[model samples]
Target: MTNGPLTLMQQTSALRQAIRNQEHTGPTSGLATGAMQGNVVILPKEYADEFLMFCHLNPVPCPLIGVSAVGDYRMPMLGEDIDMRTDIPEYYVYRNGEEAERCYDISSLWQDDMVAFVLGCSFSFENALSQVGLTPRNIEEDVNVSMFESSIPTKPAGRFYGNTVVTMRPYTPKDAIRAIQVTTRFPKAHGAPLHFGDPSSIGINDLAIPDFGDPVSVKEGEVPVFWACGVTPQLAIKNAKLPICITHAPGKMLVTDLLDADLAVF
Candidate 1:
């Protein structure tokens, strides 16, 4: 790519190709602007039922969009020619509820009994926010969204249970209200802010220290807003202690061909 800006379609294609070729390995925020990005989870088919049930119990943080057939990498419902093993910019490999390694590609690690899931992401609504003059702070600062694990416990399903994870964006009081209105139109993208004022109310100790992704500035007049995040599943994955699990790195999502507007209710 060149220093000149690329159109949304062009950027989408470029990022897709770059990721496939292992040439780009960075946070995917603000790219492919209107595309519906998804949080990824790959696990053995045996664990699929429990994990799927967990998503049902926590719709706000785990709105599922697409799921691949056993051993299949293609997600036909979300996009064309998507390969689960190589599409995401980065992936976290976990073994027995412990961190394993981070890598750009996982082709060799893929298993025949594995199933892939695509969950709705907060990035999906960023375009709508930008169009309405309420661009997210992460987008404005060109960084991955700030994510933190909250004390709020999720409903249990089988063996899957964990605390909720949230993404943060800072906005002034008036703009925060407008953001709630705009985001409520896209339920798949986490609907609306869960909390907008004090970080401690949600068990977050500091805005500058995030559990995942980069921290953006919380200016003088702005207050940090929190939204249910797809990363909540990672916590469940850890708690479940499955033999193996694979997920997209926080802020690095699976960019689908679907348009964000298509997911909006109104």
Candidate 2:
């Protein structure tokens, strides 16, 4: 609580505890540096099968890292003590496929038949990019990475389907190429840029107004780089019009015990 220097694991654990206690409710990006972060999607058992198939068909934006067993809130595969209902800084509750409310934890809303799916997040690759001296502007500004819904549609699976959502980072063309190379190592972390250069090409007309999360400034000489984002699933969840669904708030990811290197291909 005092901002005293804490070790990486300690910081992550403290953040999770604060979240569970409802003392901290904000974006998790650029925090617990080096630890792998995840985007969470929780839904009832009835919707689990179709959602799983949706993730399978859209691997780029939904590379699953861990899944809680039906009726279980713990994800032992992702961390030693990850609690699906309370670990994330913030949660979004969707009713009839629309965001109904945001809360610190989902413990009160969790049901016995609910399942939680953890998806690899671009925040993991952002850490790798930072290590190589290519830190994203959003991190430098201490803001959430800009995310937008795009024209590129995801492959439909059962009742789940929607266009992809993407996160943007501005970098010089030279740095953008290196970022692509560095990010390519973490496939689970949405490896590599989906596109670079003009935002209009991806159906993002106004860089200043992101469909999700805060917008970071794109410097004059820098081009906006786009990466397939885990938030893409929420759009699908919305399209499905499920009775209820819960997801990590935009940019607020679940910090895990696994190191970012554990997800790197090389």
Candidate 3:
């Protein structure tokens, strides 16, 4: 491997190691380029079945990627060396539906009955967008992608339910069309823009203020394109009010050894 910047073809084990060592702890967008990045949710085994069903019913916002065995931090399906407790850039520990704390590692809290779920992330499709010259605004500005709670509701499963959350990317109409085509090939990665143009249509009142992550400029000629985000699970976490729930902080993700191309359909 080259001793320079990571690329779309790069393996992500080293990046995972860096995150594990606390060398990097910020939004994971644009890093570990070719690997599939995943949004994480770790909860008690009791909630695992329902959450799995939730993913099945609401695939766009919660595409099932990998699931760790009960209490096992090692996600062999995603990576041989991945440790779910430390691979993500950051984590949110929620207590009874409220965010109690944010931390870099969750080893201290990982329980014997905890089960981790990995969901497909839009970050996995970004390189394809860039390849087609339709780079997302957040990538251009180097900020965590702006995510907002949308009016669109997800299909409920057991006790898990909530509105879908979406990440925005500003693009000209022509670019958006191309972006949709590129993203559609990666169905696991939230597949294509959900809505574009008016934010009000999706119940997002202001483009300047977002519920999670930093905002980027939506250029005058560019319209905002929305895509289902894995962060949607956070809303479900809030609604379920489980004794404990852990998730990747918005925008940060688990960079896995799975290849982005492996997620593409054609």
Candidate 4:
């Protein structure tokens, strides 16, 4: 490996180590270029089956990328070195479906019976946008993407049910069209824009403030384009009210070893 930060694999490993040590606790967007990133959800074995079905019924917002066996914290399918307890930069702990706390490391709370689920994140497609000269504003600003709770409903399964959550990116009409085509190739990365133009059309009354993540400035000639966000599963977890649930913070995704093209539908 080169002695600099240019190597993709080296950068990914270093980032993961930083996260594991609680040295880096921020969004994963625009880092580890070309590597697939994932939204995380950890639940006890008791709720694992229903959550699996939940993901199956609602693939758009919960595209299943990796799952660990009961009592296992390592997700070999996503990364051989992945430690579900500490790989993510930050974690949101939920009790009775409500966010109770945010923490850097969950090693103390990890249960032997816990099962971890990894879902594809929009960051995977953001790389594609950048490759095609349509870099997302969040990347340019070095901030987490703006995420909102939409009025759009998700397909429910058992007790898992909630509205879809979306991440926004602003672009002119011409760029938006090309962006849609570029992203459509990565279905696991939320595919295309769920809504563009009027944010209120999707129940988002203010683009200046977001339900989650840092908001970026929307240029005068640009329209806010929305894509299905992996954080949507967090909303479902809140509705299910399971005794306990764990999820990656809104924008702090788990950077995986898989390549971006591995997630492209094409």
Computed on alpha carbons, the lDDT of every model, listed in order, comes to 0.89, 0.90, 0.89, 0.90
User: Model 2, 93-136: lDDT tens per residue?
Assistant: 99999999998878899999999999999888888898899998
lDDT score, candidate 4, position 215 = 94
Clashing pairs in 4: none
Give the candidate order by descending TM-score.
2, 3, 4, 1
Candidate 1 vs candidate 3, TM-score winner: 3
Q: Write the per-residue lDDT of candidate 4 for residues 152-207, one digit (tens) a residue.
A: 99988888899999999999999999999999998888888888999998999999
Model 3, position 265: C-alpha lDDT score: 97
Model 2 residue 170 CA deviation (Å) reads 1.6
What lDDT does candidate 2 reach at residue 8? 84
- Each model's TM-score? 0.92, 0.94, 0.93, 0.93
Which of the predicted structures, 2 or 3, would earn the higher lDDT when compared with the native? 2
lDDT measured at residue 251 in model 4 versus the true structure, 0 to 100: 74
Candidate 3 per-residue C-alpha lDDT over 1-266 given as tens digits, one digit per residue, 9 for 90 to 100: 58896664444777788899999898777776778899899999999999999999999899899998998989998888888988888999999999999999999999999999999988778888888777777888878889899999999998899999999988888888888889999889999778999999989999899988889997778899999988898899899999999999877889888888998997
**Candidate number with the higher TM-score (2 or 4):** 2
Cα TM-score of candidate 2: 0.94
